[model samples]
Target chain A: MATVALKSVKKSYGDINIIQGVDLDIQDREFVVFVGPSGCGKSTLLRMIAGLEEITAGELKIDGKVVNDVPPDARGLAMVFQSYALYPHMTVANNMGFALRLAGVPKAERDAKVKDAARILQLEPLLQRKPGQLSGGQRQRVAIGRAIVRQPKVFLFDEPLSNLDAALRVQMRIEIARLHSSLAATMIYVTHDQIEAMTMADRIVVLRSGKIEQVGTPLELYHYPANVFVAGFIGSPKMNLVPVKVQSAGADGITIVLPGGGTAMIPVQSSNAAAGSAATLGVRPENVAISADGPIAGEITVVEHLGGETLVYVNVGEGPFITVKAGGDSAANVGARVRLSLKTDEANVFDTNGAAMVPKVRKPLADLEKRGH
Target chain B: MASKAQKKIGLAVLGWVVALLVFFPLIWMALAAFKTEIDAVSSPPKVIFDPTLENFNAVFERVNYGNAVFNSIVESVGATLICLIFAAPAAYAMAFFPGRKTKDLLMWMLSTKMMPAVGVLVPMYLIFRSTGMLDTRTGLVIVYTLMNLPIVVWMLYSFFREVPKEILEAARMDGARPRQQLLLLLLPLSLPGVMSTALLSIIICWNEAFWSINLTASNAAPLTQLIASFSSPEGLFWAKLSAASLLAIAPILVFGWVTQRQLVRGLTFGAVK
Candidate 1:
């Protein structure tokens, strides 16, 4: 039960700045995930908060007290690294109880705590085995069990499931979500995979090049991203961002010319939204459909059939290639002519500065979840 | 099938030839140790002779050979422990928290072993004589410790490097202090390397001849000096020399043969595949 606040946190090595300046407030029991491309300093930010890396300049407060100078062990935080850095020489039971032993916890008490953590992770039978003796997934569980025995105020996971196979990754993801709900401890997870962020986090902090792009709930980020970067980063087959000319801009709507010489009026409110200027139209895969007389025409480049849905890649001339989510049994094949129609009300418009023009009104949570965008 | 069999037999023959060549000198020495002085030095070398243990009895009865053996064991073991005490912390620092000059510092430490030991003979003798440490086991221990320090540190540094850095970070995260990190994590993880290093240091210290022969007369004499004494003005008694040499080297030879595998592993600890 702790709130972590970073005020203008910055990390730089000599002249090269890694994390420029990050200011974020993490409330107690919030599952905040930092998602970004590789080299975006997401891991660095998590490390800084875990006290594993030094903050070049900033004030970090945890539980309403400054802890920038505190060592990791004294900061009341447990971190599970990408490699699951378990002590290779130690048995699973001893590995989990190591921190307790260091704190002078009595032998019986330490054993009970270890047993509890093992039971939670379902690692009771492997208690006496060393790390080398366990499988990769079991070792990963032991790493988490080690952290669980600490019972820290905050749990920091740095791409903890990245090394696992696909099936194990999915299983571990659900288990981690269950653990978060069961423990009700604040967790800061960092991953480049958007689905993990969308499925697990209460609030997702999108980062790019050492700066936070946006911080919002999954639905808010999906339905109303603050900018083009967030729009392009949040969903599965990323949102298609196409450069187009702004035909006209008004207080209630902005009309942008489409690639095939058609125009659609996007419902956004921007006081400074101008006409005869450059802008981008952001459309998610699910928000665009194939129609016989749709404005945008293109040839299907590829078709991916994912059982219930098929992602058809269409290359409309003079704009970005667009992916349209269609019914799996639809007769969309490579080289077929595809006409794409946008759901205009759900479409987003970005101005010359790449900032998303604010929506006229927020969508209801039920409506947003029902669309499953 | 015929060519493969021929190749295998040829390789086997070459391997035996190499092994026999290496073992010839030790075999000859062993044979001479059990022979009388006359049979030991006979022309064309006696291939067959009556053997006796009188030469060993004479070696013990004539000189204080027991003192030399005791001194050798104490000096070698003491120097090995002292060198380990000095090298562990140094190697730990160089391995985990390296700086810009770390590589240069490691190379400099290893380069000290390249220079000939005879080059420092005069200066070392002068210092030992002036300090009244010329004939003491303590002096030999200090010399042997310095002699073996570089190799010990180098081996340990490489061993420590092979251990993943995340393990140490895990210990640090688990509230282990630096001393505890070294004792609980590093010492156990690299026990084989450390054991090999200690064994090498003991062998080198036991077999060292230059400093022992030049600086010590009676009290600090080790096995090397005792073997050298067999060549005294007795007109080169081959049987007595061989018996003394065998006695002085038997323990270390057995130790080397037993631990040869670990030494090879230590030598090639981090070799790239």
Candidate 2:
């Protein structure tokens, strides 16, 4: 419903900066997620956008109008906090209709709107129950229903599923995605869960230490991370980053000495990385294959047998453990010697500075411009 | 097992003994309220003496007891209401929108209560006299309100802090102004704490004797002054004094007993799971 733009937004407390200058453009109806670890300023940035926190510097615009001085209520936004924050003293219906009542909407109309929201959230039977009487998920639904009744221009969710159990988190995540599509309202969600970001976001803004690390679609980030941090943070079980010695660097590609006495030429532009310098070879668990004829050898340390996919943790020499994703029924036993084959095209090369060398052949789907930003 | 049972019985007996020890004076006073003057002052306190309501009748008839009771009720309740009106907002701001100096401010406010009231009695009395507030119910109410303000604000601040900050932030996002947040959200959430606070303030004001005796001679004198008046130069009227004291404390005793459950609950609000 509205486009939100932040131009060099910064937040600080005394000399400590919580959110460094952040520039981001969220298109109308875009489901943007601010994903980061704890103390990464994701929540603080979301609060700043919601007008709950003061932006120490820079301008924030909604619909192209700077609203740095606007109060939270005047910002036309509704938020669902992690605690649900349902009014414990009021019935579910009253909690949902609170904003409407505050806006001076007629009683009959407010009731109708609440009823409609209740039906949508499947809370019709719980309209009269207090928040204390409801289950955790039901309370979450009421929190969402409270936001829904306001019909605000933007909806902000601050780790709304962090408090729920795993199964309920997935269910609520799906419900939120459906709500976004149904309402088509611009939503800014802040969470440290990468799965939520990967599944629910139209574009994920990966932040680190108050700075924007990268901003792209889920697949774009997965296939082409901007740096080592994004590469390690975006994937499940983390990407295996092994320290490699660069043997040859050229316009064609860079050849790096892999661990356990193996060499692989990764097709990436490495103009900044010189030969004989230390660089990191980044490969996701799924991209590392366990094969008999593979060059890189290691001893299997751990085998995680998930139903659909198995994770094989291999101890390759004195370096860090490398994890390889294999079939669910993978019979690789612990203490057994195995070899890992690196998917060189899918692999990435980061110089000593941790900045990734651009891949020569970009995945068509990783194109952010084609994805409409 | 036998020793455990004996210990349990011993604990029960000890508890009863302690309870009786605490209640003995109240029981004796109640008994004296219904006795003759000679019986009240007799050696060993004449447990089997004939009971009479003559002391109560005489105490009620000799003075305007009804007017003093009315004045006590009005002054205590009026002071509590006025104190809450100021204390709630101050506590809300201190609890929710605290600054670097908020803790220091709250500590300073509580420090005022540590000073003995008599230390400033002369100054307060002179101020009241200059403002033409002597011997008036309004004057007593004002004094009681000021006397209880710091404690009231401290108690309310502690209660308000128990409310989670997230709820208030949600209210702001839901378009509630600061005033609406205080009235509609905070006051209801901390109702139990507020009730206990009002009860405590009213009890303090009702039992206060020095200020009532010093500030008012007749018109605004509360039950404390009424009880004090029983001490005359013609020797201590033990029977009439006991009767008057019993009458003056009966209402508050019953009120406290009725609200005992809520008082305990409020005091331990966040202590339990």
Candidate 3:
């Protein structure tokens, strides 16, 4: 295993900077994912690390060597493209064994490596078939198998599962997770889908406009998002941000008034801003409870039944709608008035500049159950 | 449904009629190849006559037809192979590794083909005479290679563009160097296109009458020049001329028939995709 570091890496196409001076340290055998929206530089960052794109400035190190100018093939890393990019003319065995054959490895060793990878990917039956003869999922497996035979120091996946169907994407996602653990190699995955980042990443680097926004474990990013962008991006249904103003400040917490008559105290350090400043009150959808009795009430505009959980979108007056997750068995109809309450501890507060103000907590499954929302 | 079926049948009949109309001239030419001097020139063309092999005998006896055929084979085939060798890599670079001026370069190359062949005819003749290349097969081969290179490069470039760049990049990621990429990836993927291009270049070179007529006399004369030799100031020599024309076109006709499928398939493959 080798540690990969990008020191102030910057990339530009013409005058438009795509990756603006990113510095990251990926520990050996760590699975790091770069996650961001489209037009963000996450994919560009992954390509620079793969030696596919040139770095406009700064250095990239792999295995303690400054490899800013090294070619991709000589860098001891293999990349699986977003398209899979299997050789359409070659059989599965040949496609998987191509790198070794190019390296001038003996026929016996190359064949053995290919066969071992085939067994791992369950591609033994497809050894003689071309990519055109295989389904999309099988072709992706062969693409992964091609990388495995190389035994590289790092594996790069550029949205490898984006082309597959939803069912197959989930299946392949699990397969990749298992493969990463079994091989114990450093993997850097780039994807726009936050679900993949949250589910598969050891640590996620969220990027925005070529700058690194936050780098943390999946749970860390989920709980202690560095800004409003990460706060909304990391969670499903996104965090609800209602405009609020700091009415008063005390040593223990800051008192904030909602749009209507309700007021709440959120624990925070307000040294930067005085009392009576505008801020966004951030709370996750899961933290908002649809109760029979609470401070605020609104008519349900939409109800999504997902079998295990139901998301209710409530159009509270003047402000943006709030989403609350309730039991799937809950029979809350659309246009029905429902009361909503925010769980105080689960609530988070952000300043006018979109920076979070509370300490994040990682409650175990047991701890989450004990609180009983 | 009935109307559609009737339209299909009507179109099929029209197609057959057009096809037969196209074949009529070649059929009459082959017939004239077997005719005597008088029957060949008959104004109301003799549909049925006692055919003789005298014209064929005269063709073989009067000129070294076998040597002419061999010259045609060597010149056309040699020129085609050379064109492919130069054009394939140039086309690959133009298609895949293009720069800002690639399209302009391709257009410039194609424009050379549009230049009137006669504009340089006198200069070329004088240069060949001075170089002692007047009656040499190499002289003819050089002319044909130049004539075919632009079209050959254009055809190969178009075919290369149809191949997805992802395949080549995938090959590179598989650690394939330049040579391996050409041999193992591009050549295999674009075989049909390259095959059709080779066929077209060979056909054009084989039928090149201008250079063949002016550049060579007896020693290096190709079939086209051999056919041209049948004309004299004294008379039209229709019977002999017909026979030579038939002989000259037979080889290309057979070649065109053999590769017809591949040529049509390659040409149409781009339209649908």
Q: What is the descending DockQ order?
A: 2, 1, 3
Report the lDDT tens digits of candidate 1 across residue range B1-273. 569889999999999999999999989999999999999888988998989999999999977988998999999999999999999989999999898899999899889999999999899999998999999999999999999999999989988987888788777778888888888899899999999999999999999998899888888899899889889985788898999999999989998999999988877777854
Q: Is the docking of candidate 3 incorrect, acceptable, medium or high quality?
A: medium
Looking at model 1, residue A320 earns an lDDT score of 73
lDDT of 3: 0.87
Q: Which scores greater on lDDT, model 1 or model 2?
A: 2
Name the best candidate (by DockQ). 2
Task: Note the clash tally of each candidate.
Answer: 0, 0, 0
* Candidate 1: residue B2 Cα off by (Å): 14
lDDT per residue for candidate 2 within B1-273, as digits (tens), equals 569889999999999999999999999999888889999999976999898999999899977899999999999999999999999999999999899999999889889889898999999899989998888999999989988999899889989998999999999898988899999999999898999999889888999898999898788889999988898787888889999999999998998899988777766766786
Across A171-265, the per-residue lDDT of candidate 3 in tens digits comes to 99999999999999999999999999988988899999999999988877887788888998998888888888888877667778876657877
lDDT string for model 2 (A1-373, tens) is 5999999999999999999999999999999999998999999999999898999999999999999999998888899999998889999999999999988999999999999999999999999999999999999999999999999899999999999999999999999999999998999999999999999989999999999999989988988899999998997989999999999988889999988778889999988787899999999998899998776899999999998999999999957999999999899899999988989999999999898899999877844664564
TM-score of chain A of each: 0.96, 0.97, 0.94
Clashes of 1: 0
Q: How accurate is candidate 2 locally (lDDT)?
A: 0.92
Alpha-carbon deviation at B45 in model 1, angstroms: 2.9
Q: Which candidate model has the greater TM-score, 1 or 2?
A: 2
Model 3 error, position B125 (Å): 2.8
